[model samples]
Target chain A: MAKILIVDDSRTSRRMLRAILEEMGHEVVAEAVNGEDGFVKYKELNPDLVTLDITMPVLDGIQALSLIKKHDPEAKAVMITAAGQRDKMIKAVKYGAAEFITKPYEKEVVEKILKEVLAL
Target chain B: MIANIIANYLINKGKISLDQYYEFFEELSKVRAKLGLIAVHEGLMTEYQADTVNMLQATMDMKFGDLAVEKGFLTHNQVQELLRKQADPYLSVAQVLENMGIMRLNDLDLLMKKYQVENEMSSSSIEALKSDEIDRIVPLFLPPEADEYVAFATLAFKTLMRCADNNIFPIKGFFAEKLDCQNGALQFVDGDPCLTAGMCGDGNALLGAACKFGQEEFESVNMDALDAIAELLNCICGLYASELSQKRITMELYPPQYDDTIEGVGEYKTLIFPMMLGDKLVNLLICIGEKLEFRYS
Candidate 1:
């Protein structure tokens, strides 16, 4: 299990993700509401994995992902989103997002992705 | 109804075990709870009324809401309102299964038509009646299992009919502060004690329903139903808050959270209440302090 950071605007999503990750024996090191806070938390906690939501106030996921990569270069960040953000998702891939997960998550899929991202 | 048909078909074809069917049914129950909560939030009726109807429907051949109306508990307009408040379940499910283009609309339509015939509604008079007319005729389908999927599917079907029948957008989403008034509350995980705080949302005809419903039936609020209900509250909050904020309320909303079973003892009373949805009781726990202590049942 890997240490994880969850960044999302929705409390429900964050809690759900925390449950799934913790259930799999991974530790959720920290969480942030927006990409800006996420970036700050990223610098402070430096957890093994980060799940960043693409659409957020202050700073969006792509921007935070860029900032994290700037500092760590090897930051393993996953972009999370709901439907209709296809363009932004494509951009995250280009910016080296470790993976992307959609909203209304499936536990198994999330567990598998975390394991895959942590392996690297 | 469709699920049972599909499950039966699968059973006959030797595709799944009976145990799998039971598990699916259980999950579907959660979904139904979610839908019932949404309907209540939409101001269709009170949680107790919905619960009463759900229980009555169990032993009798009657529409859940219809039973309530017959008992003089809810007005026809209220039943119509509840029916109108429903959203499309197939669309929700489809959104969840974005990758699988498995079920076609036409196929589902045929299944529905077949279902209509199987129940022996062959009279041209019944067929000619409008969709809403048919809906009033059969309020609840009472499948072998009342699950989340079934509830969602039922809501979707009703929503479509309502849209087609009424030609109106029943509700729209917006974020504002009057909606954000502390008047709207969060139910905590602890025992029956509630916090009387302002909630974020648009204060409208709906506020009366939210306040009354929140206060009436639930001691420990139902989370799944609350999430669905809160989505409307959020929309109402968004619209109401936008007007109050002058600037849009920039704060983001977290998804709905819930826990059915909790055990503890404390004087720092927590505010979470239980609201009725159909036959199920759902709880909503308000998170105010820095951390929430919880254990799931």
Candidate 2:
């Protein structure tokens, strides 16, 4: 099971992600409210995986992923976004994000992506 | 949505009893048929052909008739013929009422005329509502000045139906200075011109949506339920933002926020569309071109 960190401004998204991760036997090590906090938590907790939301206050998922990758080039980060943020998703990929998941999280897809990201 | 609006209006106007209204819908539901089914019954297409078109519809966003033509199962003229034969929801309600001996055909016709005159609706507008096309029907409910937001409203309603509940029925919308609710989720679009939109309700207005979207059942409206509501609003805004992106318009969406208190937000005028979910009332709130501030009591 992978140790995960969730960074999203929505409490609902965080809670839902936590429940899904826990149900799948993954350990949720920490949670952050936005991109800046996510960058901080990534350095402190150094989780095996991080799920970052693309649209957030302070800093966005792309910036946070860049910072996390800079600190640990081997860090695995999955970007979370709503359906439309293609431009942001492209930027996230350039920053070395391992995978991406859309909002209104589907359990099966989440599991499949998580498994693939953890294996990588 | 139009059916619900007319039924509610008739009930309130004393033209029809609440019991009669419920009975009418119940009977109508039993007889209401889908387009594919109608096409098959009319022998325009075989059952297997209709089934194939239905399956395609689940994956594609196109209408059944359009898909049928695309699949080469029917031509444009045949599809149009089938559409003409498709039952109009309002007419179905009237037919059910007559069939059930609730009202005579002549009396129902007079009542329909009265409804049109009382609501100041043109027959063409009524026909648009009967068509059940979201794009066409949403404008009739919203103020003409807010025409630019019709696309946003249409997307929001379609998303609500697709993700939350399909049984929702929308009522006419109006411009208002303030709206009060027990709980709500708000999000803002920031860019060339700012926009703010939200959904709010009293009691269990959002409870069913929360349960459906979250796939969890809660006895009451709580933080978890509100979270589901916020997620839904996020999805709606995300879609609207995507549509804007296609037009080369860039807009940033703020993370959704929610509150439980009833408050009046500052001077911006809001377009409020009230919708019925089962037995509860929920309102879709939209404000354009200005930021809003709320006054808490």
Judged by lDDT, which candidate is best?
2
| Interface C-alpha RMSD after superposing true interface residues, each candidate, one decimal | 8.7, 1.9
lDDT of 2 by residue, B2-96 (tens): 56666666677786787888876777677754566556645678768887987888899999889999899888998888778657665565556
Model 2 chain A lowest lDDT segment of ten:
A82-91
What local lDDT does model 1 show for residue A65? 94
The single-chain TM-score for chain B of candidate 2 is: 0.74
DockQ winner: 2
lDDT of each: 0.49, 0.80
Error of 1 at B131 (Å): 9.3
Report the C-alpha lDDT of model 1 over B78-164, residue by residue, as the tens digit. Answer: 767655545444323222222133333334345446645665544452233222333332223322332322322233234323321
- Taking all chains together, each candidate's TM-score versus the true structure is 0.39, 0.78
What digit string (tens of lDDT, one per residue) describes model 2 on residues A1-120? 889999998777888899999999999999999999999999999999999999887898888999999999999999999877777888889989999999889999999999999998
What is the C-alpha lDDT profile of model 1 across A1-120, one tens digit per residue?
688899976565676688889999989999898899999999999899999987666888899999999999899998886533455677899889988886547788888888888888
